[model samples]
Target: MTVNGRRVPVLSAEGVTVRIGGRVLLDAVDLDVHAGEVLALVGPNGAGKSTLLGVIAGDTQPDRGRTVLDGTDLRRWRLGDLARRRALLTQANSVAFPFTVREVVAMGRAPWASLPEGDDDEAIIEESLAATDTTHLHSRTFPTLSGGEKARASLSRALAQRAGVLLLDEPTAAVDLRHQEIVLELARTVADGGGAVVVVLHDLELAAAWSDRLVMISDGRIRAAGPPHQVLTAELVEEVYRQPVLVHRHPVTGDLLVTPDRRGSRPTRTPVAPAAGAALDSAFVKEFS
Candidate 1:
């Protein structure tokens, strides 16, 4: 894919805008997801992060512009072919029916049924389950699983698809700390395997640690885009998130760490004098007497 001799991104939003009921969800956002890199989309709640992801996933159509996948407009690709190229894992992983874990993961292979590797679906399914640490839940019905368990199982299903482009919306939202790392590691692994990964993350530290680049959005527009060190500055954090934050390097991993600047957000309380507390003390005694 090329634009005037420049190589194009694996997936991109070209001047995309989305508006619903007199409110704008996305405002002409231009973004890219490239192969061999994990891109993190982050923002405050209602900042249009998920909506932008939905646009990239083809689940939401923008009011203006278009989503391009591998240089071709997403609307032009056949649904099955598009499924084979890119797999989307939405935030909600609800299964309407009582499908077993293994059965649910196998659904990813539907697009590949006409291909030569269709017969190898079982092996692929098992591999995906093992990768996401959901193999133990293979026999359990998806609806009977816990939220975190269901999250892991759903991830296994997306992994089973073996798509070149992965669009994951908060893949670790329901998992524990350990599994959160596991999911991010799997995303890094996918990129390492020569695929493109675009993830929506609320955890700024995790996004900074795993992503090759970060795209920070606020009020339906991009606030910053670049490496963590460049994009996640104290000014940008405070301005876009509307909260004071301290952006610093971790001592152990040297990764960028974002923490709330509590001192800046509020004033600390000091002890009052005994004389100043006399009225409160008298009231307390009178109430108890």
Candidate 2:
């Protein structure tokens, strides 16, 4: 299959299987991640999206099969060499030290230390900060930043790596609405620049809007894989997500929009509590306390 007019696969996962304590996390998963395309993985919690990403990033060993990068097994590549070819942005941005934002981003250049481009670390770091809209946070300590700020800083660090492929797990989960849009747009820009991007996302609307292709996984298997419209049908989503959903094209952008079907459900409202000193009936106190 063609990806952004490119016909070659930059990353390939063949029969990848992961098992933990005899429970399958991913079973016989085969996928081709192509250059110049943004592929989004969507599924319910515990569906193994992050595990698959970990396997592809060479951070986790699979029980069977292998992940290949540029026709070579990822297991055979050196750690430093693999870092140069791909960057992984995990869901958490936990930091124990007091490193400044710039210092954290500068660490991404470690893999290029032996190359001439290593000298451009400062320039790349600045560019990555600006691209992620975190330039103003350069002097702040990473451990002191808020969740959203930390997410932006982490993305800047990953972007500074300047790798050929990006594996982002929930890159936008902690950000606000605008930053969420910014992060996804940046991923698209990376793909447009001939890099492959694989993103794990929970928002079906955003995944449908941003991804060129979608992979829906459930129960440790791929439920569907194809264009967003093909993979995000209302029937399939309702079945896999275990809830009713409405999938329709937007009137303005013509992009697919997903909304939960709540026609038969009662509108949710908070009940007013009794005053602290007010008398309570024995039945009410027994039910609550």
Candidate 3:
């Protein structure tokens, strides 16, 4: 269960905070990502979803608190060493060079350049491409691929990294519906194979459908963190997202299913903040009044 050369507690954040121009982007946030689990970060736009991913990936330093990989601080790990242990697939990846898909995926091995694991690297790269269902485009130019295709290619590259911990920021943003499901399924398979996977997802349905745990964030803090059924309640969803939602058990899987009541016509109730000392505004009071 060790990840990135560290023990089983692959990723941990304690009182983590990030600020940009005096505005708190993430405040006092604590999270843990363990091996063989898919932890989904779900929130509305500007909820610091990507910022949190950057912090975990060692791309952005937090203003306060600590992020640890295994038992060591994230800063202690060299960039190249960190890259070898964790792979981050961001939302804004673009290929300026017209490298073929295979070449692009092979770049993931740069961290292990001096290692004499040639055959293992090649097998992993090929498996990554096939897992992402981009094997057919192996010889295609990266710059010439469609948006969705490019997304899959980037994902394949991350997979090729063969890192024990994987962080994805909006991994399905540019892909079509089918590709979205495919990529999420691949993430699930990776977690099933004993890697730690953290994905920032905007689609609630997809998050509920695939994630083993859910971390809901709002206004620079974690609103709820637990299994999907406990955290993604109807009232909490409406409070954090400002949209009425219905929570039900999926008929087939019996997992929690969150459906937005867009019209807001349902008989809804106000949400009670989970923690003491958390503020409760008049609007919430009026809703339940």
Cα-lDDT of candidate 2: 0.93
Q: Please write out the lDDT profile of model 2 over residues 249-284, one tens digit for every residue.
A: 989989899999998887887765686334456558
- Cα RMSD of all models vs. native, in order, equals 4.0, 4.4, 11.9
| lDDT tens digits by residue: candidate 3, 66-146 | 899977999999888898889999998798898999999998877888787545888889998988899999999998998
Show the lowest summed lDDT stretch of 10 residues, model 3: 274-283
Lowest summed lDDT across 10 adjacent residues in model 1 is found at 263-272
TM-score, prediction 1:
0.90
Clash counts per candidate, in order, are: 0, 0, 0
Cα lDDT, all candidates: 0.92, 0.93, 0.89
lDDT of 1 by residue, 95-147 (tens): 99999999999999999997997889999999999998999999999999999
Q: Global lDDT for candidate 3?
A: 0.89
Q: How far is candidate 3 from the true structure (C-alpha RMSD, Å)?
A: 11.9
TM-scores, all models, native as reference: 0.90, 0.90, 0.86
